[model samples]
Target: MNQQNVRNFSIIAHIDHGKSTLADKLILKTGALEQRVFKDQYLDNMDLERERGITIKAQTVRLPYRSQKGDAYTFNMIDTPGHVDFSYEVSRSLAACEGVLLLIDASQGIQAQTIANVNLAMAGNLTIIPVINKVDLPSADPDMVREQLEDILQIDSTEAILASAKQGIGVEEIMEAIVERIPPPEGDPDQPLKALLFDAWYDLYKGVMILVRVVDGHLKEGMTIQMMATGHTFEVEELGAFTPVPKRIDRLSAGEVGFVIAGIKKLDETKIGDTVTEFKNNCDKPLPGYKDVKPMVFSGLYPIDGDQYENLRDALKKLRLNDASFTYEPETSAALGFGFRCGFLGLLHMEIVRERLEREYNVDLLTTAPTVVFHLKPEHGDMVVIDNPSNLKKQDRTDTILEPYLRGTIIVPDEYVGVVMNLARDRRGIQLKMEYLTPKTVMLQYALPFSEIVFDFFDHLKSSTKGYASFDYEFLDFRASDLVKLDILFNGETVDALSMIVHRDKAYYRGRELVKKLKEQIPRQMFEVAIQASIGGKVIARESVKALRKNVLAKCYGGDITRKRKLLEKQKAGKKRMKQIGKVEIPQEAFLAVLRTDVK
Candidate 1:
């Protein structure tokens, strides 16, 4: 195949804008999939992605297409994750292509991610062919969507195509547009090998399988490869490209996308952003590595059964092999026992990882409330980065504390603007600006503390907006904050996993609400269990769960109300002695029952 006949592109879009579906139609039209096996979202074969109707990972398929002009072309289309959590991942996928099909839902119009990704594509200097997907739906307004696209992106809307990916309309037109509009990858195949490793996964039989885009030179089977990032060399056991499935080839040349199989034992060694080339004939300088995806949130994952701690460790290890954005370290909580402190890209990333562990690894995990990493500087010592709240147990009062902040952009229906403003203010968000996208839709910008959004901001945003809002954010910088640690105690014993760092103004009320929720979740023990929320050793709120023996008024009636009150007073006085000797058995679920909240 000639390099001139090759076209590399990626499908960029907001969530559920028909990226995977369009990819499916293109693959089928190209005859990459036989009619007997064609299916929607065939590239999103994972059970989780199929069930959720979203693409969680980046995937690529090689298609051999013949243009209407009768010229054969080799098309490599990369499918990228659509959520904000994986925006950086999407960038890596886009980096593999010379251009992209900017897919948008015609009915939903342009979204937050659509705006962000358009900027990203411009930054990369990639050609963008706007695509209006879901045109088959009755609600689709191609003309309106086109106007919005031109207004927001300043792109000529006349070039945008209207199509229904699900109904297989405009498949040929899009394919032809890709070949005619997108330029072929530019690089000399004779140069020293330099392939950008964009994605990877762990394989039980083959070890690490790295997905790469060959920008220059060639990679073939049984060759020694060097990872520029890790400075490690490996003997390639296999080399191939995806025809929606791995297909062995003699070699992957420049302007091609494929996989390099080697005996990679540790995933960190084959980092996604690294450049892979021949060990002996390596290029003098590796390709510019990608901007690593920094984790925006942190949490603790403790096993429901203490004995499964090792299993949980193995599960995380496996999950990280495929997901480069996740990071973790060994951490311990007095209340939850042995567990690991994990970092995630966002709340959705945290949820997906938790779900995967439970469904795929078959291990029940109790995740502590999510938090953003905090910077703590002592009065006379080096600064420290803390992710777990329990680490603040020994911090100094005079030390300066800094919290991460983010610039959040939200697009919402105009009707929900009031509720959104309230939510933003409650979360310590400062309005930066507001603008109307359409008469029925508006966009807002805010400077919000990352800690506030890390926990469950998206959930609340959707809740307040009636699920008619889309949000995206970028890290601004860390700034000084008046923050304090809120601790929860059961029977006067501190529960480390239940501790969290919050702003001073919110501590008292948040503490009060926390203990109340815990009181409902924590089961009564052999003796009366007293739950307290405190900060700096001062208890702010308290709740008590009486023991079985305290229920002496089981036969209470309206006529016996006075007697019931007397018994309750007696039980309360007697609880003083019982509380001193009682140990509250907080159930596993109690450790995370109310973690759904954005704060402690």
Candidate 2:
């Protein structure tokens, strides 16, 4: 393919912004996928993606189009996920494209990820073409959304493309915009090959397949290539682009996006953001903006059965092939036995990992409450990393505990501003800025601790705003806070899995509610089970599960008062002895049920 004829761009939008429908229309117009095999959500190959109607992984396809002006162009359209949890995916996708179609829903107007991704695309030097999608809906106000685009992104309303992607409206105009507005790739194919490994996934039969963008040179089969980051080398076994699915091609030249099979045996060999180049002809400098993904939330994943621990480990290895954002290590808890301490980008990322494990791998798992990384400095020693909250018990009171904070943004309707402000205040959010984009829409910015919103922030935000709010956030820094470890005790034994790091002011209230919830979950036993919330061996709150009792005097109903008293005394004495030896059998359900104990 001619380099001048190739146009590299990606579609960026918020979740449920009609991106998949738009892609289907363009692909149909360009004949990328055949009509017989075409189904809804064509690019969303995974079952979860199709079920959720969202794109989780980034996808690319090559389309051949002949414009009305009699010019043929090979358009490389990269599709990216629209969720904030996958914002990093958007950044990586932007790095591979020369331009982006910033799609906005004509009814929803500007959202959090819309602003975030626009800034990211601009930072990556990608051209932005504002697109107003879903214009055919009765509630779609194209003029209002166009004004939002202008007010927030400074986009010219006159240049905005209005179309309904579902009904194949303005597809020709979109194609024309690509040919006229977007720039072609610029590089020398004759030079040494340098490709960006934007994504990679393991194949059961073919080994690890890497998705790459040919930045400088050509990639062909049988070529020996080296990974710039890990210094691993292997010969290319297969090479091709997703002609929607993998179609074996002879070569992928400069500016083309495709996959390279280099006989990689393990998923770890191919790192996302690593540069792939020829072994003999190497590039001078590695690409800029190459950084490892930092997981913002941490949790524990233990199998329901002990034997499935190995299976859990293997499943994670397979899942991590494409998802380098999640990291895990072997960890053990006294209450849950053996498990892995896993790190994730956020709660949604963690939830998806758990769901995929149960559904795809058919392995049941026990997950702990999600937590963020904490920095604890002892009074006499160096700083310690606390990924799980259970480790906080060892810290001294004189030590400094620094908690992670984030710069958060929320865009919602003006009517819900008061509710949102109150929610933020309760979560320790400090208002940074508030602006009115339109008469009905308002945007709020706040600085909040990671621990505050990592669990239920999105859920509450949706409820308060009546599903009209969009939120996005990034790490700011770590600061010292008045934090303490709140421990949950069952039968006088501390359960490490249920321990939490809480602020001192809210400690007593949270402790009370937690113990009450635990009391409701634990089953009644022969011996009374006492559940307590404690700090440094001091009990702050307590709840009790009453023991099951049987009447010991029923057989002596006709006996005298002395006989009845003797029976009662003997039964009481036997109960005391049983309490010393009887053990409480806690089912796996009790541990998992604690997460659902929402006090409010």
Candidate 3:
């Protein structure tokens, strides 16, 4: 059978560029989804994805349809994460396909992320089919974006497809281009089973479901399969392609994309981008191309309700089953109680996962401000995971510690270029590359120490750019620099969670801002609560707010026994929520509230 009839393609675009919306239109046009009830970004199944108007994880769906010429083809439509944090996820998604439908917002033109997506597509050696989406918008400029892509990516602009994914316009042409341009899977069908596990999920009823792109032979129900990476084998029970909804099939053949539910039940067993084959008679060599996703940004995720620890653990396990990049482990804090130390691909990825856990699982969590992992060495030659800034006990020795650095890129309007450059220098960011996207926009590259840009950098960038700047970063190893551990003291007692690693030069400025933000977020207690940032015994900054000592007794409700007792009980519960810092019992919001702003 000829494989040319199949088209394996993924949609790539910047966040809010209508990539998800475009995917939905394709799903509707191909009859994969009902046309009458078709909604926007319908392929993003998670609640967080819908709420954020972004795709945090990659998803695949099969849209089987006939072309205008009456030629039948199976379009394995895939969607990728839009943020740079999930760059690895994007790469894996691209690897599983032969072509990408590059969706560019007609109004926004080409952003920083659009270029990143195009670079990944070129690296994968996939054919690029540029689509100018959101044509219905008043600011739509398809021709302008087409020229930009052509000049930047060096690809032909004449083939660009202009469409409004919202109204389902020009979707057919995009699909037709995929069929005409993307080369079909080219491998021997009779060879032993060799499939790539680009992504997988665990269903409550179906066990471990592995999403595989078959390269050779076929996978059938009841056939035993082996994961070469883990040396684990399981019997296939269910197999089918996701239609964005579950659709069961008896078997999946070579060059086809579908999921396999082997009696495998655990996530750790089925590795992402790993190889799978028929057990006993499996392929002699494992399938090529498998790379693990590395975590760039990390933070501690603690349960707000300490009693719900088990619920939190189960929630994380469930989340991990579907997401290979999200990692966590049980951890405890002297201040925030018990929680898990979670690792993420990036900040946005961390935010999406946290949001999903709260919304989908109904689990409320207290996430410690996001932190990047840093490499540190001591005189004893001990290696430690320095996740929290407070964990670092600063000594008089300067060369004893090493901190993380980030290779960052910022793309902004050309007018505010000087302001951004000055701000970067203030934050200890070193300029590396400057490229003119057009006469109006310039992309600035920087090599900044992670400690300098970890906090408030995102907000400062936007402020400098007047909201026209977008930034992305990757951790580029550790370097020794003048650094210090700044501690936050509440009511003369140091709050362990609020301490952070900062540069020695900017300690006073950071201390003041952090203390101020902490004071604002943390509510008053029975005794006066004083928020202070200190280096060793010296107080660098301080903010004090008097506590409400008479809150409970003053607001006494004179009622029947039931109502009166309930009021007392509520007061006691409220008191319990407050964490005692020195002489004051501060509310939990103080710890959580400071995370909302940039601490300025």
Candidate 4:
């Protein structure tokens, strides 16, 4: 195929705004799949994505189309995830495309993530084609959505196409616009081979399957390619494109998207944003790789069965090949034994990873409470980065604590602005800006601590706004604050996995609430178990789980007073001895008690 006839683009939108659906319609319109074999969310092949109704990974497909003008063209489309946690995936996909179809829901209008993705596409200098989706809905307001495109997005409303992806409407117009508006890739096919590695995954039989967008020259099956970042070379075993399904091709020319199997066993060798070039005739410089993504939330992932530690490690390695954003390191906890301290983009990202590990790898995992990174400046030494609360030292040695903050954006209905503001204020947020996108919709910006956003913030925002609010955020600089490590103790022993860093003022209140929650979760044992929330050496709150009574007195219904007294004394002595050595079994729910409490 001619490079001039190839159009590389992606579909970007807010969650559930019809990105996958639109991709399906385009693929179907091109006769890429038979009607009987076609399915919804055709590009979302992962079971986790299909079950959750969200696209976690970006998927690519090549479409063969003949325009009404009788010219044949090839459409390479990448469908990207919309959730803020998966924004990195969107950025990677955008890097491989020449344009993006910015899909907006007609009924919902603009959202926080929609703006975030638009900024990403703009940053990449890609052509943006505004498409008003779900126009056929009963409550859809395409006219209002068009006004939003003009006012909020600063895009020409007249050029915006209104269509319903679910009903297969305006598929032809979208295809035509993609061809006419998006410029063809400019690359010399005669030049040396140079391609950008956007994504890669581990394969059982084929080893590492890398997805690349050719920028300069051609890549063939027998060519030897080098990863400029790793300086490793390998002979390409296979070259192909996914026309909804994998199709073998003799050569992938410049300005094309395809996969390459090079018998590379380790995924680390094929970096996400590295440059792939010919070994003997490589380009002068490598393409600038993607910025490293820092994880926001950290938690401990321990196998329920301790022997599966190796299995868990293997599972995490394989998962990392698919998701380059999350990170993990070997860690040990006194209560949970050996585990990996995992970092994720957000809570949802953490949940998805845990689920994939459990379902796909058949490993039962015990996940601890999520926490954000904090910078602690010791009075005697240098600043230390702390991800786990258990790492915090005594307050006397710490001069100051700095916590990460976020520049958060929330879009909601005008009527819910007051409630949303109250929610932010409760989370110690400082208002940055607020404006009306229209007479009915409002956009709010705030500077919030990353710790507050990690737990229940989204849940609270949705509940307070009646599920009308859409929120997104980016990391800002860390700021000094009055923070302390709140620890949970069972039977007078501290549980490392249950500790967390919190603001000093709220520590006492949260301590009381946490102890109460843990009391409910900790079952009664043979000996009375004491649950305490403490700071340093001082206990702020405490609760007791009463020991299970055996009723020695019940067996002495007709006994004398002396006999009853002797029996009671024996029971007390036995309980005292048992409390000295008996261990209190803390359930998994007890470790999650921190999340159930009102930390604010």
Candidate 5:
């Protein structure tokens, strides 16, 4: 295969903007899969992705196409996730491509993620082919979308291809645009082997399989390759590209995208952004790797049964091999026992990881409420980064606390701008800027605390705007805040898993709501169970679960009033003694009470 004939590109778009559908149509048009075997979202192989109707992991495929001029070409397409949570995936995918198909929803036009992804593509200096997708929809206005592409994104909308990915419209034009507009990957095949390891996953039979985009020279079986980052060497046993499925190939040349099986057992050795080169004749310097992804949301993942702790640990380790953005460290809680303090890009990322651990790894996990990283500076100590609220138990030790903030970009209809502003303000967001993208669409910028958006902020935004708003954000900076740790005590003992850091002004209300929710979830015990929410040593709210009444008084119903009084007193004493020694078992629901966003 000639390097000049190979075109490496990726499809990037906002959520529900037809990226996967476009990829499917392209694959089908290329005859990569037979009609009988083809499926919707063919690239999204995971059940979770199919169920959620969103792409989680970026998928790569090789399409063999012939241009109108009758020249055979190999198109390497990486389909990327559109959700803000999976933007890291998009970035890595972009690194593997020389160009990108920037798909914009025809009806929705330019969105927050559209702008974010366009910025990313521009940063990488990749050739972006503007694609107006879903043009066949009843509400679609391709002319309006074209204006948006030109006005907002500064892209030449005259060349923008209007297509319906679902209906297989304009598939040929998209393919032709790839060949005409997107440049062929530039690499020297004669040079020593140098490739970028963009992704990898663990296989039960073949060990770790890595996806790479060759930059210089060729990679083949029996070649000894060393990872530039880890300095680990392995002998490549097999190499192939996915024609929607793994098909073994003799070798991978420069300007190509494919997977390599190197008989590597451990995944950590194959870093996502590491450069791969020949061990004996390696390149002098590694390729510029990807930036390290920092997690936005943190939570505790504990096993339902304590004995499954090791299994959970093993699952996380294996899962991390596939998802490099997800991070975890050993942690323990007084109430939840041994667990891992896990970090995720967002709430959805956390949810997907939890679901994968349970469904794929068969580990039943109990996840704590999500929280963002906080910076705490104590009066007599250096600055510390705290993810768990229980670490803030010594409130007096901290002189000041700083919370992570985000520069949020939200695009909504003009009619919903007021409601969106109110929602942002309610979340402690400070308005940064507001502009009208068009007469009907409004774009808003705000600086919001990361902690404020981790839970139900997206849900609220969608509901408030009637699902008309699209949002994307990036970390701004940490700012000093009046934050306090809200602790929940069950039977007078603080439950570390239920503790959270919140704004001091809302602590009383949140505490009150938390205890009330807990009161409803906590079952009545033999002794009166006290559920209290407190800050430091001061209890702010309390709820009591009454002790289950016994038949001691029922048995003495016919007795004299004095005798009945004596029995009641004795029962009361017994109840007091039980309350002193009895342990209140907080149910799973009680532990999840902190996740209820409507506590107010």
Candidate 6:
């Protein structure tokens, strides 16, 4: 086979822009998998990926196709994560590819995330292949999309592929274009082995699977490869790319993208973006990759049933195998009981993980409101990272606490501009940049404290604009702001985990709303619970939920001794699940209600 004939590329797109579906069609058109073998996004092997309709991790597949000139060549198709949260993963994937198939949703034209991703791809110097996906949608305007790309992205749109991935239309042309347009890998195969670790994950059947792009190397079965990041080395037991169904053996040489499975047992050993070189003639210099990603959003995840804590831990570990962006630790909460101190790249990433944990792992959990880490400087000594509201204890000091802020951007119709400005002002948003996207559309930028947005601000933004506003935000480090530590008291005792820092002006409003939501979500319990939000010793907001008058061994259904004992056991279990929020042992739903606070 001619090595120069092969083309290695990845499909890049924003969320729900049909990147995965296009990969499925490419698999079908190339006859990579047997007829009917592929369902959708066959490259995304994780069940969570399928359920979420978003590619959470990067995956690669190999397909053999005949180009327009009637020549057979192999195309390595990599599907990358589409969200901003996994930008690190996406960048690493791009590093291994020579070209990218940029999928833009036709109706949406160009979005905030789409622009950001395209810029990253261009920065990587990959061959840009513009593709207008979902062309068959009623609202699709490919011409407008092309104009946007040409004008904003400064890329030629004459070669844009207008096709509907869901309908498998124009997919053959896409495969042919891959061979004709994208250049083949270039490197000296005889040189010391040097491959870029784009992504990695643990597989139960194959142990550790490391996906690499050979920059200047040749890898074969039985050869030893060293992971330079962690200084661990392993022998390559097998190497190949999936033909969308079964793994096929092929020598991975310079410029080609493929997977190498060494009998390694854990994901920790195969760090993403690490360099892999043959152990015998290992490359002297490590591969240059992006800086390690640090999660900005922090929250707590608790099992609905405390007994599932172990199961939750195992589920999280399994999830972390494929998701390097997630950071978590086991923690105990007075309000939420026992759960995890989870870290996320952003709010979207946090929501996606929570949804996946529920849908994929079948673990019902209660999550706290997402928060940005605050730098709390003690009066006497070092700075402490405060992620949990419960971790913010009342300490007597003249110390300074710096709160995280965010640079928020929103695009909305010009008609709702005033409403949006008013909303932002209420949330302590300081206007920054404003631009006109189109004659009727305007983009507004604001610098807002993270504390203000954590409490149903997104909902308020949407509701105020009647869902016409779309926004994105980036963390802007910590700054001194007018912040107050709002403590939640249940039964006159403070729940350390339930305390949070909020903007002084907005604290009372948020407190009242949160307690109200909690009152509605929390079930009646053994005793009345008073949910109080306080600053220092002053109560700012309060909500009182009536105690359960009808829960204690309500039914002794049978006279049988065994049946009566069973009823007692059930009652004990129920009582164990109830949490004392203030003076009330509230059910788990109330804790979750706080996370879904509806800003009125």
Which predicted model would earn the best lDDT? 4
Q: Which ten residues in a row have the lowest lDDT in candidate 3?
A: 591-600
Candidate that beats the other on lDDT, 2 or 5, i.e. the better one: 5
Show where candidate 3 strays beyond 4 Å: 379-385, 396-398, 547-584, 593-600
Error at 151, model 5, angstroms:
1.4
Tens digit per residue, CA lDDT, model 5, 126-148: 99998899988899999899888
Specify the poorest-scoring 10-residue window by lDDT in model 5: 591-600
Give the TM-score (vs. native) of candidate 6: 0.87
Across 51-96, the per-residue lDDT of candidate 1 in tens digits comes to 8888888889999999999999999999888999888778888889
Between candidates 3 and 5, name the one with more favorable TM-score. 5
Clashing pairs in 3: 522-590
Model 4 weakest 10-residue run by lDDT: 391-400
lDDT of 4 at 460: 91
Model with the higher TM-score, candidate 4 or 6: 4
TM-score against truth, every candidate: 0.92, 0.94, 0.89, 0.97, 0.97, 0.87
Runs of candidate 4 with Cα error greater than 4 angstroms are 551-571
Assess candidate 2 and give its TM-score to the true structure. Answer: 0.94
Selected candidate, larger lDDT, 4 vs 5: 4
Please give, for residues 1-600, the per-residue lDDT of candidate 6 as tens digits.
Answer: 477888889888877888888888888777777665556667777676777677877778888888778888988888888777777678877887889999998987777667777888888888988899988899888988888887778889999998899998778778877888899888888899999887666676988777788888798998988988888889888887767654757588888777788898865677766888888788989888657677888988999898899889978987776677789998987666788999988777888889878877889987776777888887788999888766777745586778887888787889999999998887778999998776666788999877677657777888888976777777777887656788878767886666777777778887888788877766676656777888887898888877555544556654778876776687666654564332445565655565675543
Candidate 1 residues lying further than 4 Å off, grouped into runs, are 394-397, 550-583, 596-600
Tens-place lDDT digits, model 2, residues 444-535: 99999888887677888898788999999988999999998888888788889888887888788878887887777788987788889998
Clashes of 5: 0
Residue 276: error of model 1 in Å?
A: 1.1
lDDT of each: 0.86, 0.87, 0.79, 0.92, 0.91, 0.79
RMSD of each: 4.1, 2.5, 5.6, 1.6, 1.8, 5.8
